[model samples]
Target: MSNPAISYAHITRVTDTLVTATEDALAAEEPLEIRLVHNGQQQSITVTMRSPGQDEELAAGFLFTEGIITRYPEIKTIHYNNNVATITLQPGITPALQPAQRNFLANASCGVCGKTDLDAIFAPVKKTITNIKVPAAILHDLPALLRGQQAVFDNTGGLHAAALFDTAGNLLHIREDIGRHNAVDKLIGAALKQELPFSQYGLLLSGRAGFELIQKAAVAGIPVIAAVGAPSSLAVKMAKEWNITLIGFLREGRFNIYHGQEKIAL
Candidate 1:
């Protein structure tokens, strides 16, 4: 079964001397409403804009990274319909919803999603096992590996991607979306579905590493995060605080290790 993640549109192309009408491929964007159900009660949790595929995985990943649900088994079943993902929790498992975070909502580029209270946005460090190591040469080849799997982005050039790789630099899984965080969440969700080992894999991002992305990786127990662009000050601070490896500007066999130098074998 396939949910279409790409849409087509007609457009006019204008150049220096020629004008032509053509068809263009666009990464599909749609709003997905996530809901929670337990003890016969259902409530709307958050609504986020995302591409049209992997709705269930996207919801599961969002809940885990947002500190709502810690384990995949906590989710009894995920029912997807009409762009809504409803997660039914297992018996006796109450969602860990904080008052300030309960009303969380975001757009496609929701790094912080209008949440400004650092106290509310930040969670305590997870004490992650940050000692995993990978060769520098292997790290240099990850971006191309990730780029080759971006099926939607290859067509639209409008989506961000996240991929999981083992210590030996083998590509594991990848997910793409218009939002960077959404991409990470989707990848994590897919991994969760298989009960994969999170701490043993590095996460590759198609764009800059943000604070929230680091928080998501930490929550998932992912040890290393490498991004194609730069990282924000808060992102670097959070990475170091969590002792997770963070690499930025990762292309052309060059990268800057903002934190967790020991995680990479130079």
Candidate 2:
């Protein structure tokens, strides 16, 4: 298997008048251009800086969360050419081109730097998820579970991670990338490919849960989102409006629930 995520390199470390050569594995960051082809019309969606593996999943999840394709069946084929991913939608489906116009150059650290407005950014979730419940203890344990599976993060410590877990705290799938959004996209895209329902799962983020990440989870019908860092005000607002359970500051056996706290059991 080819690992495009990390590369071994020799580097010079200088500290306190001492210099030494050391070997390190640096996280690989590369540009991935996603193109949407619908009914013979081709549009360059966006070019994102991401870690190199799971390119197809990254494209699929991005298109889905961006409202370019509503259903998995809407995607007919995904082709890769160099750093570009071209997706062909099923005939007659109109692709949303607005997201493409927002920002084509997406950096790894920011998820929504390209958005035109707050209204356009919140893609409509199908419906408000209800009646699902996860134990608070299980929620607290999620970060560790997610961290344990972060093989890439262990090596490079530069990649972000997103993991999907069941109410019982079983980890379903996890993806790591240089970009936080890319990691979630990879996980969502893999689930879409396998036709898994999102309602039964909760998402765990390695970093702060931002508005864009919350919106993406909503678009996928995921009811719960747990983050190890603080959430933005916009993230809390969107999570409440979209009926998602958003938890942040997940550390030391404590967490803050911002929205949909009913879904979490004490």
Candidate 3:
């Protein structure tokens, strides 16, 4: 299926003495209303501006990662109407019943800006195994691997990507989006659909590691997350709390282990 959220366009640069035209890709950022329904009643919950494609996965992953839905069976169905997306829960499923101590609704550009309280942001992450270990060399080579897979970024230079790799440095899956968090969601959704053992693999992101990204990885049971850029303070803290290995500044055969260094071997 063609994703309506992204497209290619010719960008023209005009100057007094010269004119240049080049093809550029645009990332779509529009409001997606996520509604929840049970029985026959519906409630309009949150609206997020996210890149198109993988709307269903975005919804499912968002809810699951946010503690809205604990099990995959809790989500009955997810439907998207152009820009508006709705999620239907199975009978007796209620995310708000626990009094969602955090407000997750916010702009897609920054996932942690809209939370009203710190506890909401610091909610306990799901448990995961820690037996997996990856070579430090895999982190060194990931940037090139992710770059090779980003066809749209090569053309437009405007998309973010998340890739899953095994301990052997083999690429298992990849997803791209205008918003980094959305890209992670797409990747997770793809893995969930394939019944891939996510907790056994490492996650590589193309952008800086943030709190929301770490939270998503933790919820998905990903034991290790490596980023091509720096990690925020909150991201490091969350990773430590969730027992996840967080690595940053991954380039040129060297990386800094901000938390959980035992998972990466030299």
After superposition on all C-alphas, the RMSD of every candidate to the true structure, in Å, is: 1.7, 1.7, 2.5
Model 3, residue 248: what's the lDDT?
93
> Per-residue lDDT for 143-233 in model 1, tens only?
9999988888888999999999888889899999998988888999999989998888899998999899999999899989999999999
* Candidate 2 TM-score to native: 0.94
TM-score of each: 0.95, 0.94, 0.89
Kindly give the stretch of ten consecutive residues in candidate 2 with the minimal lDDT sum: 95-104
Candidate 3, residue 216: the lDDT equals: 86
Error of 2 at 19 (Å): 3.1
Tens digit per residue, CA lDDT, model 3, 90-160:
88776752323334556777655555666666444776976898988767888898899887677557888
> How many angstroms is residue 244 displaced in model 1 relative to the true structure, after the best TM-score fit?
0.6
Provide the overall lDDT of each model, using Cα atoms, as 2-decimal numbers: 0.87, 0.88, 0.80
Residue pairs clashing, model 1: none
TM-score of 3: 0.89
